[model samples]
Target: MIAAAPASGPLWQQVLVALAVFAAALHVLHDRAPGLLRRLRLGLARRLLAGRAPLARLLGRWVAPPPPAGSGQTACGACQKAGCAPRPADHMRNTP
Candidate 1:
Protein backbone atom coordinates (compact mmCIF):
# COMPACT_ATOMS: atom_id res chain seq x y z
CA MET A 1 0.00 0.00 0.00
CA ILE A 2 3.02 2.29 -0.37
CA ALA A 3 2.48 5.36 -2.56
CA ALA A 4 4.76 5.95 -5.52
CA ALA A 5 6.97 9.00 -5.75
CA PRO A 6 6.03 11.82 -8.07
CA ALA A 7 6.83 11.26 -11.74
CA SER A 8 8.60 14.58 -12.01
CA GLY A 9 11.89 12.99 -10.82
CA PRO A 10 13.76 9.87 -11.93
CA LEU A 11 13.37 6.68 -9.89
CA TRP A 12 17.04 6.66 -8.93
CA GLN A 13 16.83 10.18 -7.56
CA GLN A 14 13.80 9.26 -5.51
CA VAL A 15 15.51 6.17 -4.12
CA LEU A 16 18.61 8.18 -3.21
CA VAL A 17 16.55 10.82 -1.44
CA ALA A 18 14.67 8.17 0.51
CA LEU A 19 17.91 6.48 1.57
CA ALA A 20 19.44 9.81 2.64
CA VAL A 21 16.41 10.67 4.72
CA PHE A 22 16.44 7.24 6.35
CA ALA A 23 20.14 7.52 7.20
CA ALA A 24 19.73 11.00 8.67
CA ALA A 25 16.80 9.92 10.79
CA LEU A 26 18.74 6.92 12.09
CA HIS A 27 21.70 9.13 13.00
CA VAL A 28 19.51 11.62 14.85
CA LEU A 29 17.71 8.88 16.78
CA HIS A 30 21.00 7.17 17.62
CA ASP A 31 22.43 10.38 19.06
CA ARG A 32 19.33 11.74 20.79
CA ALA A 33 17.73 8.51 22.12
CA PRO A 34 20.07 5.54 22.26
CA GLY A 35 18.04 3.60 24.84
CA LEU A 36 15.00 3.74 22.63
CA LEU A 37 17.07 2.41 19.73
CA ARG A 38 18.34 -0.50 21.82
CA ARG A 39 14.84 -1.43 22.89
CA LEU A 40 13.62 -1.24 19.34
CA ARG A 41 16.41 -3.51 18.16
CA LEU A 42 15.65 -6.11 20.86
CA GLY A 43 11.96 -5.97 20.10
CA LEU A 44 12.59 -6.39 16.40
CA ALA A 45 14.88 -9.34 17.01
CA ARG A 46 12.34 -11.00 19.27
CA ARG A 47 9.57 -10.51 16.78
CA LEU A 48 11.69 -11.82 13.95
CA LEU A 49 12.79 -14.89 15.86
CA ALA A 50 9.62 -15.60 17.77
CA GLY A 51 8.99 -19.31 18.57
CA ARG A 52 12.29 -20.29 17.00
CA ALA A 53 14.60 -21.69 19.66
CA PRO A 54 17.58 -22.36 17.37
CA LEU A 55 17.38 -18.97 15.77
CA ALA A 56 17.01 -17.34 19.15
CA ARG A 57 20.16 -19.04 20.37
CA LEU A 58 22.01 -17.82 17.29
CA LEU A 59 20.79 -14.29 17.86
CA GLY A 60 21.79 -14.50 21.53
CA ARG A 61 25.30 -15.47 20.49
CA TRP A 62 25.48 -12.52 18.10
CA VAL A 63 24.10 -10.11 20.71
CA ALA A 64 25.73 -10.92 23.98
CA PRO A 65 23.96 -9.96 27.20
CA PRO A 66 25.09 -6.99 29.22
CA PRO A 67 27.73 -7.56 31.85
CA PRO A 68 26.73 -8.34 35.41
CA ALA A 69 26.28 -5.52 37.92
CA GLY A 70 29.26 -4.42 40.02
CA SER A 71 31.66 -5.69 37.42
CA GLY A 72 33.74 -2.54 38.05
CA GLN A 73 34.10 -1.84 34.39
CA THR A 74 32.29 0.19 31.77
CA ALA A 75 32.11 0.51 28.01
CA CYS A 76 33.97 3.80 28.41
CA GLY A 77 37.47 3.62 29.89
CA ALA A 78 36.75 6.15 32.66
CA CYS A 79 37.33 3.83 35.57
CA GLN A 80 39.78 4.44 38.44
CA LYS A 81 43.21 5.64 37.37
CA ALA A 82 46.27 3.55 38.17
CA GLY A 83 49.19 5.47 39.76
CA CYS A 84 47.94 8.82 38.46
CA ALA A 85 47.63 10.45 41.88
CA PRO A 86 50.59 12.44 43.26
CA ARG A 87 52.24 10.99 46.40
CA PRO A 88 53.22 12.98 49.48
CA ALA A 89 56.96 12.39 48.77
CA ASP A 90 56.62 13.82 45.26
CA HIS A 91 54.86 16.95 46.60
CA MET A 92 57.47 17.41 49.34
CA ARG A 93 60.40 17.14 46.91
CA ASN A 94 58.78 19.62 44.48
CA THR A 95 58.02 22.21 47.19
CA PRO A 96 60.17 25.35 47.09
Candidate 2:
Protein backbone atom coordinates (compact mmCIF):
# COMPACT_ATOMS: atom_id res chain seq x y z
CA MET A 1 0.00 0.00 0.00
CA ILE A 2 1.12 3.59 -0.78
CA ALA A 3 0.59 6.61 1.48
CA ALA A 4 -0.47 10.04 0.26
CA ALA A 5 0.63 13.45 1.53
CA PRO A 6 -1.93 15.59 3.37
CA ALA A 7 -3.70 18.23 1.25
CA SER A 8 -3.42 20.77 4.11
CA GLY A 9 0.33 20.10 4.16
CA PRO A 10 2.70 19.05 6.96
CA LEU A 11 1.27 17.91 10.31
CA TRP A 12 3.54 20.38 12.10
CA GLN A 13 3.23 23.41 9.83
CA GLN A 14 4.50 26.06 12.28
CA VAL A 15 5.37 26.88 15.86
CA LEU A 16 1.76 26.04 16.63
CA VAL A 17 2.72 22.40 16.46
CA ALA A 18 5.33 22.83 19.22
CA LEU A 19 2.83 24.75 21.36
CA ALA A 20 0.11 22.15 20.77
CA VAL A 21 2.44 19.31 21.64
CA PHE A 22 3.53 21.07 24.83
CA ALA A 23 -0.08 21.80 25.81
CA ALA A 24 -1.14 18.22 25.07
CA ALA A 25 1.71 16.80 27.11
CA LEU A 26 0.86 19.04 30.06
CA HIS A 27 -2.83 18.15 29.78
CA VAL A 28 -2.12 14.44 29.67
CA LEU A 29 0.29 14.56 32.59
CA HIS A 30 -1.57 16.97 34.86
CA ASP A 31 -5.20 16.72 33.86
CA ARG A 32 -5.52 13.07 32.90
CA ALA A 33 -3.35 11.83 35.77
CA PRO A 34 -3.28 14.52 38.43
CA GLY A 35 -2.85 12.39 41.57
CA LEU A 36 0.43 10.84 40.49
CA LEU A 37 1.71 13.65 38.28
CA ARG A 38 0.99 16.56 40.60
CA ARG A 39 3.93 15.72 42.83
CA LEU A 40 6.21 16.07 39.83
CA ARG A 41 4.91 19.60 39.28
CA LEU A 42 5.26 20.47 42.98
CA GLY A 43 8.83 19.20 42.93
CA LEU A 44 9.57 21.18 39.80
CA ALA A 45 8.25 24.35 41.42
CA ARG A 46 10.30 23.71 44.56
CA ARG A 47 13.44 23.08 42.53
CA LEU A 48 12.82 26.18 40.45
CA LEU A 49 12.55 28.25 43.63
CA ALA A 50 15.71 26.77 45.18
CA GLY A 51 18.85 28.99 45.14
CA ARG A 52 17.24 31.59 42.86
CA ALA A 53 16.48 34.89 44.56
CA PRO A 54 14.22 36.22 41.77
CA LEU A 55 12.36 32.91 41.62
CA ALA A 56 12.14 32.86 45.43
CA ARG A 57 10.75 36.37 45.50
CA LEU A 58 8.25 35.51 42.77
CA LEU A 59 7.17 32.42 44.68
CA GLY A 60 7.00 34.35 47.93
CA ARG A 61 4.80 36.98 46.27
CA TRP A 62 2.65 34.18 44.91
CA VAL A 63 2.26 32.32 48.23
CA ALA A 64 2.34 35.00 50.94
CA PRO A 65 -0.09 37.83 51.54
CA PRO A 66 0.17 40.91 53.74
CA PRO A 67 -1.36 40.51 57.19
CA PRO A 68 -5.07 41.17 57.02
CA ALA A 69 -6.72 43.77 59.18
CA GLY A 70 -10.03 45.61 59.45
CA SER A 71 -13.17 44.84 57.44
CA GLY A 72 -13.14 45.16 53.62
CA GLN A 73 -9.93 44.32 51.82
CA THR A 74 -7.91 47.06 50.11
CA ALA A 75 -5.39 46.54 47.36
CA CYS A 76 -3.70 49.95 47.24
CA GLY A 77 -3.45 52.87 49.64
CA ALA A 78 -6.21 54.42 51.80
CA CYS A 79 -6.60 51.64 54.29
CA GLN A 80 -7.57 52.25 57.91
CA LYS A 81 -4.75 53.65 60.07
CA ALA A 82 -5.59 51.52 63.10
CA GLY A 83 -2.46 49.73 64.26
CA CYS A 84 -2.38 45.99 64.85
CA ALA A 85 -3.51 44.75 68.24
CA PRO A 86 -0.87 45.16 70.95
CA ARG A 87 0.24 42.19 73.10
CA PRO A 88 -0.09 41.99 76.89
CA ALA A 89 3.72 42.29 77.16
CA ASP A 90 3.34 45.93 76.05
CA HIS A 91 2.06 46.71 79.59
CA MET A 92 4.69 47.03 82.41
CA ARG A 93 4.95 44.02 84.75
CA ASN A 94 5.64 45.32 88.26
CA THR A 95 8.58 43.55 89.98
CA PRO A 96 7.82 44.40 93.61
Candidate 3:
Protein backbone atom coordinates (compact mmCIF):
# COMPACT_ATOMS: atom_id res chain seq x y z
CA MET A 1 0.00 0.00 0.00
CA ILE A 2 2.98 2.30 0.30
CA ALA A 3 4.64 4.15 -2.64
CA ALA A 4 8.43 4.44 -2.52
CA ALA A 5 9.99 7.88 -2.34
CA PRO A 6 11.21 9.46 -5.57
CA ALA A 7 14.60 7.99 -6.58
CA SER A 8 15.86 10.93 -8.60
CA GLY A 9 16.68 13.12 -5.57
CA PRO A 10 19.96 13.09 -3.55
CA LEU A 11 20.10 10.54 -0.73
CA TRP A 12 20.09 13.19 2.07
CA GLN A 13 17.12 14.97 0.50
CA GLN A 14 15.20 11.70 0.31
CA VAL A 15 15.88 10.98 3.96
CA LEU A 16 14.66 14.38 5.15
CA VAL A 17 11.50 14.16 3.05
CA ALA A 18 10.62 10.74 4.49
CA LEU A 19 11.09 11.95 8.09
CA ALA A 20 8.92 15.06 7.56
CA VAL A 21 6.07 13.05 6.04
CA PHE A 22 6.14 10.50 8.88
CA ALA A 23 6.10 13.16 11.64
CA ALA A 24 3.21 15.07 10.01
CA ALA A 25 1.09 11.93 9.75
CA LEU A 26 1.84 11.01 13.36
CA HIS A 27 0.60 14.44 14.56
CA VAL A 28 -2.71 14.05 12.72
CA LEU A 29 -3.58 10.58 14.18
CA HIS A 30 -2.40 11.35 17.75
CA ASP A 31 -6.04 12.00 18.79
CA ARG A 32 -9.28 9.98 18.11
CA ALA A 33 -7.63 6.60 18.90
CA PRO A 34 -7.85 3.80 21.60
CA GLY A 35 -11.65 3.11 21.34
CA LEU A 36 -11.55 0.57 18.46
CA LEU A 37 -8.19 -1.00 19.46
CA ARG A 38 -9.50 -1.99 22.94
CA ARG A 39 -12.63 -3.68 21.48
CA LEU A 40 -10.55 -5.65 18.90
CA ARG A 41 -8.26 -7.07 21.63
CA LEU A 42 -11.28 -8.20 23.73
CA GLY A 43 -12.92 -9.90 20.73
CA LEU A 44 -9.70 -11.75 19.81
CA ALA A 45 -9.23 -13.08 23.38
CA ARG A 46 -12.86 -14.29 23.55
CA ARG A 47 -12.43 -16.21 20.29
CA LEU A 48 -9.22 -17.87 21.58
CA LEU A 49 -10.82 -19.35 24.79
CA ALA A 50 -14.45 -19.71 23.70
CA GLY A 51 -15.61 -22.86 25.58
CA ARG A 52 -14.47 -25.88 27.69
CA ALA A 53 -16.35 -28.26 25.33
CA PRO A 54 -13.97 -27.60 22.42
CA LEU A 55 -10.89 -28.26 24.57
CA ALA A 56 -12.33 -31.54 25.97
CA ARG A 57 -13.18 -32.73 22.45
CA LEU A 58 -9.63 -32.04 21.20
CA LEU A 59 -8.07 -33.93 24.15
CA GLY A 60 -10.29 -36.93 23.51
CA ARG A 61 -9.06 -37.19 19.91
CA TRP A 62 -5.33 -37.07 20.79
CA VAL A 63 -5.11 -39.12 24.03
CA ALA A 64 -5.60 -42.87 24.50
CA PRO A 65 -7.55 -43.75 27.64
CA PRO A 66 -5.72 -45.34 30.56
CA PRO A 67 -6.00 -49.15 31.11
CA PRO A 68 -8.53 -50.26 33.73
CA ALA A 69 -7.05 -50.58 37.23
CA GLY A 70 -6.11 -53.98 38.79
CA SER A 71 -5.36 -55.51 35.37
CA GLY A 72 -1.53 -55.42 35.50
CA GLN A 73 -0.36 -58.07 38.05
CA THR A 74 3.13 -58.71 36.66
CA ALA A 75 6.38 -56.65 36.70
CA CYS A 76 6.06 -55.69 32.96
CA GLY A 77 2.26 -55.27 33.10
CA ALA A 78 2.40 -51.48 32.79
CA CYS A 79 4.34 -51.63 29.50
CA GLN A 80 1.96 -54.22 28.09
CA LYS A 81 -1.02 -51.92 28.66
CA ALA A 82 0.91 -49.11 26.92
CA GLY A 83 1.40 -51.44 23.88
CA CYS A 84 5.24 -51.49 24.19
CA ALA A 85 7.45 -54.45 24.93
CA PRO A 86 8.89 -54.43 28.43
CA ARG A 87 12.68 -54.13 28.85
CA PRO A 88 14.48 -56.49 31.22
CA ALA A 89 15.16 -55.07 34.71
CA ASP A 90 18.92 -55.36 34.21
CA HIS A 91 18.79 -52.57 31.56
CA MET A 92 16.82 -50.19 33.81
CA ARG A 93 18.54 -51.04 37.10
CA ASN A 94 22.06 -50.09 35.99
CA THR A 95 21.09 -46.66 34.45
CA PRO A 96 20.18 -44.84 37.69
Residue 3's lDDT in candidate 3: 96
lDDT of 2 at 90: 62
Q: Which whole-number lDDT from 0 to 100 does residue 72 have in model 3?
A: 66
The better-scoring model by lDDT among 1 and 2 is 1
15 Cα displacement, candidate 2 (Å): 2.6
- Better-scoring candidate (TM-score), 1 or 2: 1
Q: Provide the RMSD of all predictions against the true structure, rounded to 1 decimal.
A: 9.1, 11.0, 17.8
Rank all candidate structures by their lDDT, best first, as comma-separated numbers: 1, 2, 3
Better of 1 and 3 by TM-score: 1
Query: Which of the predicted structures, 2 or 3, would earn the higher TM-score when compared with the native?
Result: 2
Candidate 1 lDDT score at position 94: 52
Per-residue lDDT for 13-76 in model 1, tens only?
Answer: 9899999999999899889997877777776666656646887757854554354568766444
lDDT of 1: 0.71
Question: In candidate 3, what are the lDDT values of residues 1-85, reduced to their tens digit?
Answer: 9998767879899899999998876556444554444454455545544546777445444343333458765665455564355
Which stretches of model 1 miss by more than 4 angstroms? 1-6, 51-96
Clashing pairs in 1: none
Q: Can you give the TM-score per candidate against the true fold? A: 0.49, 0.41, 0.28
Model 2: lDDT to the true structure: 0.62
lDDT of 2 at 20: 90
